[model samples]
Target: MSPTVDHYRIVPELTVPGYASDALKAIVGATHAAVQANVDNLGAGTPSRAPRFVKLLRDKQIVDDKNQSIATTNHNETVSALRDIEASMDVNDEGVDSSTYGTYSVAGDAYVDIEKAVNQLQGTINDAENAPGPSVDAAGRQYWPEAVEGPLRTACATTAATVEQRMWDATTDIQRHAEHINNSAPDNPTSSGYGGTTAPLTTPWSGHSYVPPADAGTIDKIKGFAANELGVAETGTNHVNRPYNIDDAWCASFATWVWKQSGINVDWSNKNYVPSVWSDAAGKGWADSDMSSARPGDLVVFGGQHHIGVVVARNGNSITTIEGNSGDAVRQHTYNLAGGNFTGVIHPPAKTPVNA
Candidate 1:
């Protein structure tokens, strides 16, 4: 009577047929559709939602990792290449045969070329390994891989490893070839005339004649004779010659000894006196007043004709001499011509004719 205040009575009117069942089915269908829509939107979010700096850092890290891997691989490859080169070298005689490389000698032009190439390759590796580290730009961005790209990448890119291996192989082959040539070479070649009919005298001075061998008067011969007496000293156990005691100053005697060894007939009353040698040289017309014209095998008088020695070598304004009584033993000395009281240089006579 009060306008259907009981709601149960209204629902019962709808339930008279399949009305309740239809309402439940409609509600279940709506729920299923909403769930499926949410599932479709999963994993579709943008990275831009994150901070800009974080994104930049992440990208930089990824690039750095990749570059590091590249650098490591390059380094290992370079080392392996070098090792391969070393292993290919052979130090045997067959390796250096001229027929092998179409060259007579392994130390010739071909070897030089190989050496240069190998050195260049090694330099590339050294440069890359020692290159500077990464750099930071104005905006806090980092940069690397420049040096690696410059030398390392270029060296390892092409047939460089093959070239390096070949170079090393050639180097070893040449070394072996050089050894073969040296071993097979004659002790004295025909050009040197050492073992030929025209060979110079090899006999020691017999004192029967004052004439030296044809080659004995040369600068090299004089230096050789003086060099032989390098350690000789005035010792009581062994003296060089009579009237020339080891205790006494033997500079003049040493000069005379060298001259005698060279087969030069020197007549001196007092062999211990330097002035005597000078006077004898002057009388023989062997004295050269100009110091600049001094040659090897020439006599040099120093300290007012007090000390004397044989000139071994000369350069502009400087001279090397082999002297006795220097530090009480025969030794070489270098002097400046401008500072010392260097007297005239005396040239020894050329090879004297042997008395027939």
Candidate 2:
């Protein structure tokens, strides 16, 4: 037997025969259709628990909190852009005389703005769909049962590609009509916005082009503190003279010290135990599993939840961390993110540095 396939609305390409307003109306309809298709793909109207797609988005850190979902946020942004485009157009026949009809035109910038919004939404959808889902242990305990999530993921991908392409085609329709319209449109505006950022620096002492100064934020200051202690070693034997007055394992202690020195308040009692500190950070909504966007100074819990370190830099799967007791000394080491030991990344509380 064959499998069932759900059919969705396919927005047709716009063809403006008379005025730019004609094209604008078609584009607006296409945008709305795209929005509806995404909503359906994400299972918005379902009566049960949140759909697996929504859960995956939250798990991947694409959506920051449990209350927000990827589809609804993009839907709202795209709809807002459509409303602005509509408002900028002359659609009413209020008081214009029959002899002199108002020019049916939209601001070229308005069309460009909508195009940008759609392009952004498309990229967001692609990222959420491609991000790695939650992990499952060998005991077969799943974060989300694959039986439920697998089909949803496949369907969402198909719908996203179809709807996002429709949205892009709407932009193309705008460009084709704008050439004939008197409004000032950009010359060959691509689907991409502005330009892409440079890759992160891999070597130590090499500065990142996108990063602010060490004193710019609390996180940077924490990283700066760790970076300053890169070669400090234990003064006594058997981890006795660990820095920060730590008695035993100093990884968590070093992490806490960096946090405090950078103006972040952590539970001093949780300083020695890595799991305890991880739990505390999780309770504060600071623990995240999205390693791809992990920021410098994020406390990384790893090695079977036994060790912790401050992230100094990351590029792709490579993470550079400065640890307090890797070889009885403060040293920089690299770790692959694909390794299962990378438990979580804790984002310390954000604060303005006194020097900034």
The models' CA-based lDDT, in order, is 0.44, 0.47
Against the true structure, whose TM-score is highest? 2
Model 1, position 133, has a per-residue lDDT of 39
Candidate 1, residues 122-188: lDDT per residue as tens digits? 4544453345534557886544444444333333222123333443454466446445543453321
Candidate 1 collision pairs: 96-177, 234-246
| lDDT computed for candidate 2 | 0.47
- True lDDT of residue 281, candidate 2: 69
Off by over 4 Å in 1: 1-217, 236-247, 350-356
Global CA lDDT computed for model 1 = 0.44
lDDT of 2 by residue, 110-212 (tens): 2344345445544543443345443456985434334323333333334334444444454455345534431242211111111112223233322222334
RMSD of 2: 25.1
Worst 10 residues of 2 by lDDT: 187-196
User: What clash pairs does model 2 have?
Assistant: none
TM-score of each candidate? 0.36, 0.38
